[model samples]
Target: MSLAGNRATMQSGIGMIEVLVAIVIMVFAMFALISMQIVALRYQKTAHLRSMASQFSADLADRMRGNIRGAHDGAYNLSRQRYPALGDPAPSCPGPGSCTSQELAAKDIHEWRTGLGNAMVGGWGEIAGSVADGFTVKVYFLDMLAAADGATPVARNCQPTAADPVLHREVSCYAAVVSP
Candidate 1:
């Protein structure tokens, strides 16, 4: 019963609800992408910190091996509390002025500690095992990668205990134990 002109006047178009739904879906997708990016960055930082810790420990161990006498004489044994300062000198042996294994070891410690401080955030190294029974250099760092609770482990001898769950906030501390 309607005329041809009247039928042509009814236009086909998108509804408001459909547009809103599309916008909501796009917003969710964007949020998910952002979340994934954040997690990936966190894990990447953790891996980097781990790599630095292992490499530093290995370097110290190699230095220790080069001076077996110093290793045995407790020259390379550094306690948790006392560390080599930045201004410490490291002299080489078998050159113009001969240096003892002890002097070489001192240089190694100073350089190693300086590297640790430079490479990591609040990074530090300690000797867990004694020279007689071999040695384990435990590298400690404030793991900024993970979101921690309230009471993180402080740097101490044989510290960062064997506990898994972190009780501290701000930062979760991690320790990499490397043997020499």
Candidate 2:
């Protein structure tokens, strides 16, 4: 055979091998893109949850500010274990019948807790400290990704302590110190 024909024979399967290599590379790229998409979706959900917690915290702050007297009287103080029943006592002062500071506080807490429960999974709130020391409003909820074992790293990481209600669990906390 001529030298040119010999060269063509040697190069016969090179194009097929190159095409296979390209296909393999493309497959890997596609898998990487899919992985990135999954991570984006997870982060999006986390952001949405954090936003809800922030909104709830602000709402409670606004409520306390609206009733400064009750807030000052330590009426909004709630323990981490305390979960006000949903729709309890109907969070209302009623027409012309004014409610006391404590009553109003209870109403506000009930309404707020109800909203939290409705908006989140295993959602709860804790009002620690007092008006004199500045109240710390904390919202807690279960996030599968936010395990205390360091499965997922993010903001508001819930560290398990001897004082924690649930030790070594996937709990996410959003806290705000409200003077009102």
Candidate 3:
């Protein structure tokens, strides 16, 4: 073959190699992009789950605080007697100190739950009702640390039974029994 033709053929081969290399590089880049996207999605999901958990905790805490705050002398009851059993009494004032502090606390918690059941919607509400994956709110009379110790004096620790895993998340709220 002529030298020029040979050179031309060699050049064509080089061009093909270049094209293949470029394609390989592009493939690698696409793979990296996909990997990064997956990682980002996972992070977003984790953040969302954490945010939901925190929000649930805060909402419950706020309601508990409101109930306790409205109580006279920081002496409120925690029971499961009232409707909407999450823990808030109806707006009606306790007439002539009729309900004991403990009873009121229980009634309030019951009412609070009832309200929460009414308020929660969609998947969270469904999970809350299911015995397999639901959660519960417990009221502890002792401080946060003391309640875990199991030795501290507590007025009561209302927890769900073993059959109820829905309330499995360790949740507790403590308030000064005496008004500041």
Candidate 4:
């Protein structure tokens, strides 16, 4: 073959190789971008779930505080009892000083839990073990009101319930100042 023809053939071969290499690099880059997009989507989903959990927690905490503040003597109670296929009765506030402090506290707790359970049933709040996915709120009260010791009697401390099945392990807590 003529020298010019041979050189042209070699140049075409190099061009084909360069095109193939570029295609290969482009394929790998596309795959990497796709993987990164998938990771970003997953992170977005997790953030959404966390936000929902926070909203639910905040609502529950606010309601509990209201109930506690409205209770007599700033002493309230909550129960974790679940009835067998039946709902507990609504709470009735006894006349002032009619019930013992312990009884009043128990009644308050029952009322709080009853309100939470009702919310769950109404689809306004999540319940533990009701679904495989989602979150639950567990309510807890301080052993004693710190404000009882010369502080304002209207002050209260509330904490989220412990970790359990079907609920996230993280807990959130808050304090409420009851209006006299």
Candidate 5:
């Protein structure tokens, strides 16, 4: 071929190579964008769960403050082990002073527990200490990523000791302290 023709052919081949490189870089950039979106969605879900937990703790604290007598009597103390039976009938308190302090506490707890369970996945709760010495309210929910391993979810006690399941299980907890 002539000199001009040979140079034209080489230039066309180089242009094609550059186009291919640009296309490959664009594909990699698209994949990176998709990965970042997925990570942002996961973090958003986690933040939502944490917000729900904070609301639940605040709710129970308000309930305790409303029933200071029950709170001081230790009637509000609860644990995962003492879950109220779902079938048990709620106490009747249509009028003021219709129920005793303990009865009111029972009713409050049943309502609180039901609401917590309905709002979160695999949710559970506990109340420790008493109004006399201040109190702690804790709400727990399943850890979505950790539970993907297909193991049974367990409730965690924020107060941990040796052999505590909180160390091994897929659970998350939120706790708040309030003095009545």
Candidate 6:
């Protein structure tokens, strides 16, 4: 073949190789974008679940602070395994009612449980300790924690690291110790 003809054939092959390389790069870029989008969605769900748990803990804290009698009398103490029945009626303690502080505390727990059940997936909560040494309120709900035991201590970690394969896991405990 003539020298010019050989050069033209080589140049065409080079151009096709370059085009194939560009297509490969674009495919990798699209994959990276899709992976980032999935990661963002998981993080958003985690943020929402954590916020709900924080709210639940704060609610019990406010309730205990408002009722000093109940806090001191041990009426506010609830263990992790115990949960108020869902359908149980709240006590008849309307305004000007003669119900004792302890009675009102029971009603408060019932209502709080109802709220948690409605707002969270598999929600559970407890109030431990007393006014003498302070109080702890723990709320358990479904989240994306990698590790958790039911009724974990306040010092334990509630959310697990994402390195583990446990995506979309549940945390069974969260605690807030309060002194009123």
Q: Per-prediction TM-score, please? A: 0.73, 0.79, 0.41, 0.42, 0.78, 0.73
Distance (Å) between predicted and true CA of 56, model 3?
A: 1.5
Model 3 misplacement above 4 A:
1-14, 69-180
What is candidate 3's local distance difference test score? 0.40
Instruction: List per-prediction Cα lDDT, in the order shown.
Output: 0.65, 0.72, 0.40, 0.41, 0.72, 0.68
Clash numbers, per candidate: 6, 0, 31, 4, 0, 0
Candidate 6 lDDT over 1-180, as tens digits, reads 568767765643457778899999999999999999987887787677668878887887788777778888888876433432367677888774676888878878888888998888757666668788887666766654323434332224433221122322444455567786
- Which residue pairs clash within candidate 4? 77-105, 77-109, 78-109, 138-161
Local distance difference test, candidate 2: 0.72
lDDT of 2 by residue, 1-180 (tens): 558766755754458879999999999999999999988987787788889998998999899998888898888875444432344556667743489888888888878877898899867776766777887777777677666346532243533221254552566777778777
- Reference-based TM-score, model 2: 0.79
Error of 3 at 176 (Å): 17
Largest TM-score belongs to which candidate? Answer: 2
- Is 1 or 2 the stronger prediction by TM-score? 2
lDDT (Cα) of model 4: 0.41
**How many clashes (backbone atoms < 3 Å, residues ≥3 apart in a chain or on different chains) does model 5 have?**
0
In model 4, the worst 10-residue window by lDDT is: 122-131
Order of all candidates by TM-score, from best down to worst? 2, 5, 6, 1, 4, 3
- Candidate 6 ranges beyond 4 A from true positions: 1-14, 83-85, 144-169
| Cα TM-score of candidate 1 | 0.73
Runs in model 1 lying further than 4 Å from the true structure = 2-11, 80-97, 147-158, 161-180
Off by over 4 Å in 2: 1-14, 83-92, 148-168
Candidate 3 lDDT over 44-138, as tens digits, reads 75445445434554555454455554343333332323211233345443663786544554455455445444533211210122112222433
Candidate 1 has its poorest 10 consecutive residues by lDDT at 162-171
C-alpha root-mean-square deviation, candidate 5: 4.1
- Per-residue lDDT value at 150 in model 1: 35
lDDT of 1 by residue, 107-145 (tens): 777778778888887666666555667776766666754
